[model samples]
Target: MTTLVRELWESGYMHTQDIAYIRPDGYIKITDRLKDVIKSGGEWISSLEIETILSLHPSVADVSVIGVRDKQWGERPLALVVLKPNAQETSADDIKAIAEKAVERGIIP
Candidate 1:
């Protein structure tokens, strides 16, 4: 575990939390977990954390996390959010900006 954490800390690549872990029974199971990390502009961004924050907004209904290409950032986090009906006055850029402030996650994206 130490090695895993150390590598994540150093490389800042896709996170294993969204990938897998060996079970105590030594078997693999399809467990519920956060999605993969997205790297943007040489920075590692946690899609899980961003999705969690986006879900906190009262207007938000459902959300999907994905990586989108950016000319300078390599890949950027693009939140595909479903808003509650009758909810108005919110924008995609708003969510993106707010998400950047919600968490550190051992990284600053």
Candidate 2:
């Protein structure tokens, strides 16, 4: 019980493992899980957000994002995607283009 208590408060806050942000309208929006967040160059990148964006592609049957070690950025996102069986024409570049567009639109960084 004591160990569990310590683990929960190890970060000085209760470890709910939830990542959330407060919008300008004063509403709190829960974004992702802390365990799934990628810490890169001092910025928090939500893996769930990336997966959600990638899943929007017509060819993407399923998608997941995970954090990988990076010497410079500390951590970087690695997307694992599964395309639709009939969408063989969809290339990796096509998937990347979607993410790039999201970046240009300030949707993800």
Candidate 3:
């Protein structure tokens, strides 16, 4: 057996490397992965959640969020985005506006 298969067999469960939360409704919500979560000002930020919010924008084709060093917050999320092929008019401010809306809605803290 391969190393990965053997490890899984020994562990009895596959390590998906995902982090989740069981909500008050008793539903499981997959937040993000251990490696993908960003620690900012002692708070955990889900990169996947940010990506999901950014993807809702019409001009966003693809997006990835990563943590970057910040003096004040310890770390901050940096979004790398790919605009739609016809999205020549979309600016960085436009993408930022989407995230700002999410903050206003309390979807992101």
Candidate 4:
């Protein structure tokens, strides 16, 4: 992980505006660096982490996770997703709720 992080920074391949990458191995790779990550409340809330988890849902066709300013935590990760076509039963909130449930189940949280 350290090596990957170093390469990511050194290669200059990631940006704040880029989208996240979801690997076939069920690992979410951060394709962008948004604001150097949020360091508040003794926790490093990585946008990539949130993106990866949100993207695990079957409905997400494309996803990008960004950190937004917050008064309490200084920053909070916002998951922006693009759904696949022909999605008839799923909504944005539904995907979020599913992801939240996954987290609660200790599968992603």
Model 2 lDDT at residue 42: 95
lDDT of each: 0.68, 0.82, 0.82, 0.65
Name the runs in model 1 displaced over 4 angstroms: 1-35, 103-108
Candidates in order, TM-scores: namely 0.57, 0.67, 0.67, 0.57
User: Tens-digit lDDT track for model 4 on 1-109?
Assistant: 5643444355665434455788999887866453645565556766666677777788788777665556687655567678888667878788789667866886543
lDDT score, candidate 2: 0.82
lDDT, candidate 3, residue 98?
Answer: 91
lDDT by residue for model 2 over 1-109, one digit each (tens)?
A: 5654565567687554567888999998878765878899999988888989999999999886767667789878878799999998999999999899998998887
Q: How far is candidate 4 from the true structure (C-alpha RMSD, Å)?
A: 10.3
Candidate 1 accuracy as lDDT: 0.68
User: What lDDT does model 3 reach?
Assistant: 0.82
Instruction: Give stretches of model 2 more than 4 Å off.
Output: 1-34
Which regions of candidate 3 deviate over 4 angstroms? 1-34
Q: How well does candidate 1 match the true structure in TM-score terms?
A: 0.57
